[model samples]
Target: MSAEFLAELATLTDPAGILTGAATDGYLLDQRRRFAGRALAVARPRDTAEVAAMLALCHRHRVAVVPQGGNTSLCGGATPDSSGQALLLSLERFHGIDDIDADNNTITVAAGATLASVQAAARSAGRLFPADWAAAASCQIGGALATNAGGINVLRYGNMRNLVLGLEVVLADGTIWNGLRGLRKDNTGYDLKQLFVGSEGTLGIITRAVLRLYPAPTAHATALVPVAGPQAALELLHELQAAAGDRITSFELISAPCMALLAQHFPALPQPFAPIPDWLVLIELADAGEDSALQDKLAEVLFAQGLDEALLAQHASQSRAFWELRESIPEAQRLEGVSIKHDISVPLSAIPDFIEQCGRALLAAYPTAQIIAFGHLGDGNLHYNIFLPDHSAGVYAEEEHINAIIYREVAERRGSFSAEHGIGQLKRGLMQHYRSPVELALMRQIKQALDPHNLMNPGKFLPD
Candidate 1:
């Protein structure tokens, strides 16, 4: 039966489309190299028709299908199970931009197109695709939309979910749903495209998307300010918003540990701070006029608030240097070695309390733990990670206990355990613990209604 399935799958696309044995090894391993699995074969479908045909064949054969885009999922969302009975579907072949409507300010692209590619296409057309992050160069549109990814710009443009106007998806049973409408206002009925936006490929495979774009910003201003603490950071955020309005695009919070990590691992990178302040806020503003005016407006606000130590960018290179410090943090952490990471969000007002209380609790439990807390404070999401005495995978033995302390604090503050990152296999178990019964029930019912056979990305997003 396995041989028969592979033979049939090869017929759906060219011989190069099917990968088996060691050729499928690369696709099996995840981004962080934490999770690895086995697959009967890796299927590279060239277009929506091929994807639909492959899914139809799998449906008939009762074979499991795990959809993967770019293989950059941080939570092992795209990895196949260990059973070796599943077919891994790679969307790499479905590349390129379909269309870019400058008048409508929208770009239609194949799901496999990298976020960077889409951004370039939009820029060439004199528009902006605001969904961005460190992984923009390699992370594909389908995975970004599937996870509803959030980035620094999320404070202004919102998440990938907000940028998407419509989607073209291939359902579990190989039915193509063409709902790629580019209208800004559509109040006809339930928005079906949303179901697949953050579904993590459990309900269907996102083949294409019509994403909303924005006017390119003509002016940009960036600055890095040392704050007393999270409370000071919060106060500064509001003050800047009041002065700059929606032009304030990013407001990132960086802990002292992050600066130390950068200094230790990325020594060549500019460390503008002296003696490493306990906290720092990197603020950016973008608008339609000249950058000098925007820069002056930002400087006036900071000086008025008595933030004399703020380092404002004088040119484009200086601005890039400020952002590089923020963007290079994850790599610095990776170089530092293994650590238990959490992507969480709470009410903006509760951030200061959450950081203080959560840090205190974690320290009490593990005295040697080095807490590295930082992220998009403007959007209430923080990539709070902890490094233990044992800088190895063995540290994961304490992950559950550590997560309990932090998640409990988040729960108490009405925050979320999973923020921008989707609940892939890594956090699926937490769903039962953190989510209410009714909410879980609704998700299960939706999964049942859509992929009744449970063949679509089996053992992910939803719990057993």
Candidate 2:
């Protein structure tokens, strides 16, 4: 059956695009190595026409197809199932920047282009593409849009959904929907592009996108300040935003546990202070004007508020160093040990309360657990992760309990269980447990409407 499907796929794709054996290994596994999927073949398409033809063939053969990008999905969204019955579709060859309209502040980019490439293109045109994450170098623009990713700059510029003006999608039946209108205001009808933006390829494949750009920041000021706790950190966030106005581009919350993991694993990295503070907020301010005076304004606000213990970056290297420390937390944690991770968001006002309550609850339930909490506090999203220092026997068994305790608190405060990460294979069960019946039914209805045969990334996002 697989051979027959591959023979048909070869007719639409080039010889270089087909991968039969070991070549499909990279696309078969996820970034975290949590899920090892199997694929009959990896079909790399050069353009939208090839992709459409390939999908049409797959649909005709009734063979499942998985849309893969960089395979950097934390939730196993791009990885195929273990059945070896699916074809992994790769978009690497469709690499091109179709257009860069500097006058309109928009760029037309292919889905295979990396986020870093997009950022560099925007910079080359004297503009900025604000959507960024740690995996920008390897993650593709298509996956980012599919996941609706949010990163450091989400506080100022919005997520992938907000930055995207239009998209070119290949629907389930291999029909092309070219809605790549770069206009800012178009109230024609239902925003069709949005349906596939965060759809995770369950509905269709994103072939190209029209991304919005911003004026590049000419000045940058970054600072690392110590705080007493989450409450104090929230207070500092408010103060800095009030003083710096829209210049406050990033406000990251780093917990003491995260600092310890960094110190223990990555000793060579520069420490923010001699003894790490219990809590720290890594703040960054960017401005289009060269003489924004961001550093002076930050100093004034911190000193006036009696939060004087701070480290300010006077140069570009120092600013990078500060960001380096913040960015290295994930790697440090991975080196430290296994952890139960979560991406959650709450009301800006309820962040402090949520942290305190969730921490108290988790500690009471598992005494040896350490909360390695950190994330973009300015956007009210936290990577609330848990690690057991003692490595108890039942730690892994309590994964469900840990998730329930945290998600229950999130529900009480009207927060999201999956913040920036999309509900891929990892969180599909959680979606079934948390989402209201009506919401779940609506999603299934849409999925059936778009891909009634379920040949497009069958076992992801929506549950059976």
C-alpha RMSD for every candidate: 0.7, 1.3
What's the alpha carbon RMSD for model 1? 0.7
lDDT of each: 0.95, 0.89
Candidate 1 residue lDDT tens string, 324-434: 999999999999999999999999999999999999999999999999999999999999999998678888999999999999999999899989989889999999988
Q: Give lDDT: candidate 1, residue 177.
A: 94
Write down the lDDT that model 2 would get: 0.89
Error of 1 at 321 (Å): 0.8
Model 1 TM-score (2 dp): 0.99
